[model samples]
Target: MGNNLWKDTWLMTVRNIKTTLRNPFSFIPNLIISAFFLLVYEGGLSGISQLPTFEGANYLAFILPVSIVSAAIGGAGGAGQSIVKDIENGFFSRLLLTPASRLAIVLGPIIAGMLQLVVQTLLIIGIAFLLGLEVVTGFGGILFVLLIAVGWGLAFAGYSAGVALRTGNAQAAQAGTFIFFPLIFLSTTFVPYDLIEAQWLKIAATINPTTYIFESMRTALIDGWVFWDLMQGVFAILIVCTITITFAAVSAKKAVSRG
Candidate 1:
């Protein structure tokens, strides 16, 4: 309700961005880890796409979404860790003393993490491009892919920020963020859900929301501008954000009360 509420959040986000840029090495690992998995999987699992289920599919295109998802997770996890550091170092306490919106403190990391993901997303996609993955949707599609990456990153950042405020524990926040990886794998990370032969894995993938996120990204990369996939991805992000950010915002409020 404050007139300058957004200004505070933007300044907070800028502060976090400067902190991240000061230590450039922190940003490098996310790109490296994503590229490593992309290359390693392309080398080892290229043949998997030859199966009847794949039926003329491109494996690199198939896994590009996976790589981007990994990149998003890494960036989101880093955001949470940085928030924990601030909380530990008493900077968060300093913020609590200001009339700045509590929402600003909670949202600053989400905005910074999303902005950081823009760079990481481009890195993952650039590597994919160098390795011979072509975007069927061309320039517009490329931008759309970036949007999907941001959505997922925003969702993850919300969850991470919530965990950081809830526990104020670095280890717990890291573990909480890492737990989302299992959901990624359980969804269609390595193979198509219909192509998966394992009954249990198939069932889990069927139920997992990330499967739709991957499907949306994959559809954008290969199938051009399909309205359904884009809509599905947006809705999935809404579900995740509604749960994570809502919880995170509430958790942040509670943390302030406790502080």
Candidate 2:
């Protein structure tokens, strides 16, 4: 049974990739938007580093992880939209009629989304390098950041997938995008935590998981590797992923049943 489920998952993933390639217009727009933000942030606001906590380094390094997260979140939103489109077109219903596991069906699109996000991240990082952004931690730090970004992508994708499955509407599924942006911007992604003066934003940043993620990436990239800080970020992401994936699985089951 486990083997069959694994095989079904692989097949579903392949199908999802094929669909994504066939409908590139649906996903490419989000990638372009994310790339635009990455460029603007790196080029326009990087000079802000001369202000305070960011003085010792270029602000592009600080903002890189945030850009990665943004890319992942945007890609997940697009994937959720694709899921909603499939539902609307009755393709999701046809898939449900097969013996494939509902969890596999839900995860397939998310996996494809994450793959796209990874490609976007690589491209962005290359662009940053071309713009004279230096990676202090070198290859190891880059690998670590990529892993964490992908983990966060999967977690967010799972949550978005759940929303998509529940609503069966692209607009509703896309709403998850709004939920994360504030959480991400309010955190220590662009500026240091100590530099934040706004009471409300400070409060929000303290509770936002993105803060931990940024801290982890910061320590890995800017400073020497710190295991404890990295562990904290990893733990937070793992817990969130577990919860969100469970939610997605349940929602997918329900959607399959209803279909």
Candidate 3:
């Protein structure tokens, strides 16, 4: 059963990737937006690093992880959109009639999202390097950041896939993803936690999972390995994945029942 599940998941993931490749329109816009954010923020906020409280002189390094994480999570909707398309076109129902594992039916798109997140992250990191950003932890740091970013993105991809399974509506699934935009911005996206003056915003950022994730990525990129922060980030990912993946599994079961 485990081997069959893995086999089905691999097949679905491959199909999802090919489907996404054939439709550049689905994923290209997110990359463009992420690139634009990296360029614009690095240029406009170059002065921020000079602030007394800021960690490094290179603003791009400080902000590059934000761009990577944003790009990864922003594109997570592609998985759900694919599921919605499958449902709308009757493919999902036909798929339900097969011997494929239902869990893999839900997980396949999410695993595809994880692979896509890695690609997008590496591309963003490459662009940052071209713009003079350097990681203190070097290649190992890059791998660490990618792992964190992909893990966090997996949680979100699960949320997106859950919405798609529950609603089977592209618009609804897309709308669900938009809810994360504020979560990104409300966190310490623009400044360090200590630098935030607004009490409510501070409270929000303190509670926001993105804040810890960002700090973990920033630590790896600029501050070397900080065990506590990295662990906090890992914990955040696990917490989110627990909730969202469970939601996805329940939604998938419901989808199968209705299908």
Candidate 4:
């Protein structure tokens, strides 16, 4: 059963990747959007380097993780959209009759999203290097940040896939992804947590999972490994992932029943 599960998941993951490559239009726009954010911050927000949050560090470096995080979550949007497409076309129904592992059906697309997130992260980092942002953690740090970013993408993808399974509607999946943006935006995204003076905003940021993820990424990129600090973010990820995967599992089972 274990071998079958792994094989099924791997094959489904490969299928999702192939489908994505064949239709680049599905998710390429997400990378473009992330690039736009990175560029805007690089040019327009350079002045924020003086803010207490950054404390004289290059603004681009401080916000690079923000842009990467944006891209990571965008991958989930892509996953959700794909699931909707599958559901709309009766593809999911066919899969339900197959001998494939049930969880694999849901997880395969998410693993693809993780791959997308990791690749996007590397490209963004390369762009940063080109634009004169120094990577303080080097190759090891690059790998570390990639793992962290991909974990985030997988976690968020669970929520996205959950919504897609529940609604089976493209628009709902897209809207749900939009809802994810504000939570991260409200957090200490633009500045450090200590610099946030607004009490309500600070509290929201404190509670947001991405805040810890962003802080951990920043630390990995600029401050070194710091396992203890990174674990907080990991814990947040586990919580979010657990909740969403559970939701997705339930929704998927419901979908099977309805079909």
Candidate 5:
């Protein structure tokens, strides 16, 4: 029975992908925007590593995780916006009438959104490597990065989608993007946590999950693979995924039942 549900989910996922690709303009802009930011960040950070805290690490290597996190968060918010669009066009209601399981309907948009994230992540990593970022942990480290990226993307998407379902308005759904930006920027992604002067920002960085994600990626890519660090990141990912997915599922069910 579970396998059947997942099979149905995959079919729904494929349909969602087709619907998304039908609007190339809607999807391509995000890739372009992410690429632009990747360039600016890598270029800006390349010259800043002479600072004592960098300790001779390649600036591109240092910033790669930041770019990944940005892309995932952006992609998740984009996914929520797409859900709003579907609601506006009555596509979601149409899906509700179909035999597809509720989980399938909920995960379909998420799967499509993850595909976009994967593309952005690959493009960013390629560009970073071109700028001389080296993966010290080799293939395994690269795999770890990809796993974290996917986990973060899914977790954020679930949270954003839950909010969209509850609000049932595109403009309100967009608040997730605004909320995510400060969280991303205030973390240790751009600057080392220890270097932060403001007590508040320092305290926030210590608590922000993005900091752990960046630290995990940095350790995987540059500092050699450490089991405990990877485990911490994995644990965080699982917790976020569980909470957000539960919220999304509940919200989606409520929305469907109300209709």
Candidate 6:
């Protein structure tokens, strides 16, 4: 049974990846938006680095991780949107009739989406480097940044997938991802937590999981390895994943029964 699950997952994952590749329109927007944010923010907010607290800091490097992390979180909508299409066109119902393990079928697209997100993150990072952004931790930081991106991507993909499975509405699935947009901006997107003078926003940023993840990647890019900060990011990812994955699993089961 375990071997069959693995085989089913691999086949489904391959199919989903192939489908995504065949239809470039599905993911091109994500890449474009990520790159656009990186360029716009790096250009517009570059002066933020001139502040006393940011002395000698390169704003592009400081904000590079923001683009990577945002891509992971926002890029997940593609998975949900794809699933909604499957549900709409009756593909999901047909797949449910197969002998494939339900768990494997549910996991396949999420994993495929995560792999896509990782690639996007790498591409964005490469662009940043081309734009003169430098990582203090050098090449090793890329690995760490990828790890964090994967965690967040997987979590959000699962959450998005859950919404798709439950609603079977493309717009709802896509709109569900938007609910997180505020989380992105409410955090330390513009400035560091300590430097954020707005008391209310600072309070929100303190409790925001995005802040920890951002700081973790920032540490890798600008401050070198900080074991504590990285671990905090990992813990935050795990917590979010725990909620999102459980939601996905339950939604998958419900979807199967409804079909």
Residue ranges of candidate 6 with Cα displaced over 4 Å: 1-3
Query: Whole-model lDDT for model 5 versus the true structure?
Result: 0.80
Better of 2 and 4 by lDDT: 4
Residue 193 Cα positional deviation in candidate 3, in Å, after optimal superposition: 1.4
lDDT of 2: 0.78
User: 1-259 in candidate 5: lDDT tens per residue?
Assistant: 3436788779867877787778777657766666666678777767777788877777777788888888877767667877888888898889777776877777778888888788778888887778777888988898889889889899899998998887778888876668777667778866677767799998888787788888888889878878888777777788889999899988988988954
Model 2, range 1-259, lDDT digits (tens) per residue? 4436677778877887787789888667766766676688877887788886765877777777787777777766656777888898998888787777776777677778888778877876777677777777899988888888888888888888889889998778766668877857878766788888899888999888878887887777777577897777798799889998899888877888754
Best-first order by lDDT: 3, 6, 1, 4, 5, 2
RMSD (Å) per prediction: 2.0, 2.3, 1.8, 2.3, 2.3, 1.8
lDDT per residue for candidate 1 within 4-78, as digits (tens), equals 678989988999899988878877877798999899999899899898887677899899888898888778766
**Distance from true position, residue 137, model 1, in Å?**
1.2
> Which sections of candidate 2 miss by over 4 Å?
1-3
Collision pairs in model 2: none
Report residue 10 deviation for candidate 4 (angstroms). Answer: 2.7
RMSD (Cα, Å) of model 4: 2.3
Q: Residues 1-259, candidate 3, lDDT per residue (tens digit)?
A: 4449989999999999999899988878888888888999988988988898884447888888789888889667678888999998998888788888887877788888788888888898899989988888889999999889888888888889899999999889878988777768888887788889899999999888888898899888888888997788899999999998899888988999854
Stretches > 4 Å off in candidate 5: 1-4
Clashes of 6: 0
Per-residue alpha-carbon lDDT of model 6 for 214-236, expressed as tens digits? 88988888888889977888999
Of 2 and 5, which scores higher on TM-score? 5
Q: Between candidates 2 and 6, which one is better according to TM-score?
A: 6
Residue 37 lDDT (model 3): 83
